[model samples]
Target: GAGVSQSPSNKVTEKGKDVELRCDPISGHTALYWYRQSLGQGLEFLIYFQGNSAPDKSGLPSDRFSAERTGGSVSTLTIQRTQQEDSAVYLCASSFMPQGSGNTIYFGEGSWLTVV
Candidate 1:
């Protein structure tokens, strides 16, 4: 089975622009999550969707960031009015269930965003 994959591995954009990043999760996995890891920072959860449950969006940093999952699989994260502070690694992961505190999550290499 194919693992999760992301595109553009690297992206550079100017301030105040909008960018869209894509993620393809593994097949048959019912849970998908998006996270961000800025330089020297920890992984911060962004949004997550599992089957028919409402998405958890508590970790989205600001109104500029938003995401959606279609068909319970592929997802895309969009940042409007991008800022330099948004530069970071956007990672996508998927699993069979909501991972517990210690459960492992397989991660994509991540899309590196650089705001100039």
Candidate 2:
């Protein structure tokens, strides 16, 4: 059973550029979620997909941020036009159920994004 994983561990881009971050959830997990944590800030929910339900993207900061989950497993978060404010650690987590209560989410190390 592989744990959640994220690619590029770190990403550096300029303003107005586009960046794509990838996530691989644990095997057999039915729920996946994306979150962003800026330096010295709390985790902000981005999007989530569970089973066959429609994804919840309410937490996405802006229209520039979008994501998709393929085959109920892997997911990718794409920033259409990167900005300095978009720079943060992108974290992905998966759980056995759609939502975990009491802080049961297992998070990846996160993909650090830097916009210069």
Q: In order, what is each prediction's RMSD in angstroms? A: 1.7, 1.7
For candidate 1, give the lDDT. 0.88
**How displaced is residue 4 in candidate 1, in Å?**
0.8
Q: What is the lDDT of residue 67 in candidate 1?
A: 87
TM-score of every model? Answer: 0.91, 0.92
**Candidate 2 on 46-92: residue-level lDDT in tens?**
88889634468899989999888889888889998899999899999
Off by over 4 Å in 1: 52-54, 101-104
Deviation (Å) of 36 in candidate 2: 0.4
lDDT of 2 at 55: 64
lDDT of each: 0.88, 0.88
